[model samples]
Target chain A: MEDALLQAFLFAQETAEEDEGSLIDVVPGLMVWTFVTFLIVFWVLRRFAFGRIQGLIDQRRDRIREALDEADKARSEARELRDRIAQERQQAKMEREQILEDSRRQAQRQLEQGRERADADLRERLEKNREELDAENARLREQIRRDVVELTLLASEKVTGKVLDEDDQRRLIEETIEEVDVKRLASEN
Target chain B: MSPLLAAAESDFDPQHEFLLEEWIPLHLGPLDLSVNKAVVYIWLGGIATILLGIWLMRFGLSLRPDRRQTTGEAVYDLVQSQIAESSIPTKALHIWFPYVASLFLFIWVLNIIGFVPLPISNDTFDLFGVELPTLGIYAATANLSVTLALALITFFATHVEGIRYNGPTRYFKSWIPEGAPKPLLGLIVPLEVISQFMRLISLSVRLFANMLAGHMLILVMLGLIFIFSAWWLVPFSIGFGTVIYLFEVGIVVTIQAFVFALLSGIYIGGAIEPEH
Candidate 1:
């Protein structure tokens, strides 16, 4: 069988040499060479080239993904910080308004209290002036009454035109006084 | 005659240019262990890919990536999202990510190497009695055997993952849809088997045809310069060749690598689930 195969190979080789560019010709030697070459190439590339290159590519992809995730996290953190700052600013504005409102209310109460105290002082001064004026008017009336009695007594003396004893003078004055008191009592009735 | 003029005088054959010359000849009992130009380029391309990968890995996980690190990350991102995550099931992405990514890098490096001018001797004619006809550069993926082997790997991986995920019996049972009539299954089962095999052919041919066609078109365009031997044809031929070469390098190389990896992922993912 081996000898037959050898004869066949030799025959094919001879024919291939004669008929160049024959499509159906099978050159067993060349076939073996090509297969061996292909096998060596495939094995070497698989072991060394493909495996290492793939690992590097995968690692690069993983790094890019991690970087993207980190960027997203940073973006969210910045948004949160802005939101908190805005909230703080709003709170501060509200507190300022609250303090202003409290001060205004305090000023209003002070103004009202001052006005009330001034009014009460004016009222007390007016009452005191009216009471003093009444006392002065009552004293002035008693003085006018004493002057009238003196004038009436002088007129009685001028009408009699004579020297009078002490008992007589006293009787005259008492009579005059009783006549004045009778006239004032008739008017009051 | 100068070697260049001698090489230019020779007939330009695309097949002859692409054919591999044995570099190191060895043999086992039934195996031919001769290393060829394509095999050498494959080794060089593989080593270049490994060195670049090691250089990028040295950057580790830098916070500020330099140009090399950035490029490394970009490649990883493309494979992870475009191929693995998009095509494979979520649960199976981790397990299959390396295979899909490695496939993309390996194929891409191999495809792009065609643009770099590495001189290989054509065995067709003795130019000025020197035996070496002309020098040419060829992409390894342009060869059908290489593409076929790659497709076979995907094919085996798909079924292996299917069995691993769904168990042996369940994986086989998944060929026929659930709730299908027994009579319909008779038709469906064979079609399913054929379609699975078709994946192998389609995947292989798709890559093989695209690479081979692109390289051949450039070679043919450049050969026009030699065929005409007119100074006037140089501008057009060389210009068009350059344009096509740039297009292949920029567009074809990237799309082919991406398609192969994506299809492999889809096939494996489909096998695992089998519903869609």
Candidate 2:
């Protein structure tokens, strides 16, 4: 029985003698080797792969922030442009109203001057007509006096063959008209 | 001779009673890699976890998460908060969570596999020319390969986190903290460098030792049931086996998984926060 147990122990350790050898040679020290390998691999991976990925992530974050800032700037600029356009439109509208008001005032002034000139022309025509009527009335009165004097002289010539003076003609005309009216009335009675 | 050595050998090998070779070939390939049965079960458990995780993620996701998704999310958050963020930075933690969670769940499922009943017996099967041992991959934690793979992953993650936290020059300096009294650094630096390399072995061995010891104990206990001829001995041994099996289901699997995850966290934490 001791031999069998011894045999088992030998079997466990035998592969170490082979030239190509099994891992058993290092088996006793396996723990030490494993520990060392693990640490070295851990260190190498940490330095190369992990560090690079982290940098990439940080860079991506910064890019996103910059994009957001650009978007904000664009929005603000658009709003400012809209406000400026609104201000310009309002100023233009006010200027248009001022021009319209000025045009109305100019037309009103021209109309007033045209009306004043027509009124002056009407007043001058009325004064000239009044003078022409006065003149015509004096000429008709003279013609009537000349015809009455001539008629009185022709009547005198036919009756007594004599002509009257100018002053006497005037005074005789007034007296004959009054004497005629009294004689006509006495004959009718 | 020691009494213990005598008892260890004379004992009619419980493993020998069953004609393991008559039923199946022990050596599998040119390397004569003995297919550890538990190793196969470990692979099955890992595959099951991956398939289930994918199915749940694919069909169960909702804008307003359903109950399944809610449960998954809760567990995920728990792992993230308790294990991941505590060790790694919040910035880098999300990137590492998937790999960490995969390792955790994979080991967990593998460890618990022994408790789960297999539809097919592990008994040897007839092959093309000869009988072949049951081909199965046990909980990877039970085998050296799976544990080594996990350690390698941890090893890679640590370095990655270290680099992210500190550039190469600063990272190497982290092996020895800032204020070690310049003269003492020469002595301490070699020790620090040696310890740094030891982390991989430590990581693998911790899980491997716990899992290997537990499986060997269970195997011995179950193998004992087959050794005795008395009918009464069968009942007693079976009862004890059942209890041990149940404990494995409840405690061993969870504890081993936690240990692996905890160690991973520690390794990553040390790398990122060298100040600690």
Candidate 3:
């Protein structure tokens, strides 16, 4: 294999100088075509192909940024709504407690007023009953005293066999009232 | 008839494939600027590259991408991020990204096309009183002049960018390391100058040799069956040739194009910023 390679190399070395169109020979035409072709390919592809691709990449990037911004906006709005809900819940709880407190205070005031009114009515009824009983007691006492005086005068007339005059009757009633306590009699009856 | 028999029947000189036979002879002053196989292959490569680029990237491009568009985008991204972004500086990327990407696709297509057997050869043989053209394999990139021309473009672009960014005095001086001793200056300057020229040779020769070597190996393998003209040698010839072909197609073809573009980027980028 080494000898084969060496021979090929030697043969190439031998032919390279003699052959103007050898494998290693620098052909000017081929070089110019390569340069021209390469330049043209570079220009055409860059103008059309890569340019559009870069544009797509930029577009996709912008879309991704927009999506992220929208997501952030949505998240913030949701947070704000949640905070509002929490605040409302707290306020509602305070309002409910305040109403309950006010109801309890009103109920207490009404209960105290009702109790005072009932006591005042009971006291007035007691005072009126006492005054009526005192007036009746006085009237009964007067009737009983008058009946006793009349009986005393009739008994004196029958026993003494004489008719009493108005002065004698009055004198006899006074003497009987002094001897008999009418207040004690009325209390006993 | 078997492919081996046909190859054996012909006077198959492995080296003859690289030889450029002019189809139309055109002379300008003293130079023989003839239309030859290499020139034709270059034109084919250029045309195919353009067609591929247009079909994939230009036509039917939407916000919604298809398979072809996806592939094209992948290639573009690879070239931009991996090659141009890494090697070329950001400031000059707009100008040179297209240049480097075009160079990559152009050379890659040429290399791939070289492996394809095309009916464009002067070599012919008599078969049943009918002459038929031989289907041969050749690459424009295999030629020294072609690769040199490409390297020369990079070589000039590098220096041009360097000079453009930094003045000629500073750019040339950048080739020499900063704070070197005065006594070593004499040796350093010449070595640096030689190295600059060496970049041209290295870039060109690397591509030329890899392509030439792969093609030469396959040719020699095919040539073996013809030289021996034995039925038993057929299997070995076809087997080795197939392996080499596959290897070249899979690895060497893409690698050479990538390295060329990568090196071109490196050279141009290094020139733009000497400190970098």
Winning model by DockQ: 3
| Per-prediction interface RMSD in Å | 7.4, 11.3, 2.5
lDDT of 3 by residue, B1-276 (tens): 567667655866777787788889999888777898899999999999999888878888888889998999998998999899999989999999999999999999999999999987878768898898789899888888899999999999999999999999999989989899999999999999999999999999788877877888888888877776777887999999999899999999999999999999999999999889
How high is the lDDT of residue B40 in model 2? 41
Better of 2 and 3 by TM-score: 3
Q: What are the candidates' individual DockQ scores? A: 0.24, 0.01, 0.49
Q: lDDT of candidate 2 vs native?
A: 0.57
Candidate 3 backbone collisions, by pair:
none
**Candidate 3 structure quality by residue, lDDT tens digits, A44-146:** 9999888988899789789989999999999999999999999999999899999889989988888888888888888888888888877777877887798
- Compared with the true structure, what per-residue lDDT tens digits does model 1 show for residues B1-276? 446544775855555656676778877778876888777877887887777766775445586688889998888889889999888999998788888888888889889886777655545456677665345667888777888888899999999999999998999899877898987888999998999999998898777767777777787688876766655777898899899899899999999999999999999998888876
TM-score of 3: 0.83
Off by over 4 Å in 3: A1-21, A99-189, B1-10, B125-131
Candidate 2: C-alpha RMSD after superposition: 13.7
- TM-score of chain A for the candidates in order shown: 0.51, 0.48, 0.65
Give me the displacement of residue B27 in model 3, in angstroms: 1.4
Global lDDT scores for all candidate models: 0.77, 0.57, 0.87
In candidate 2, position A9 carries an lDDT of 30
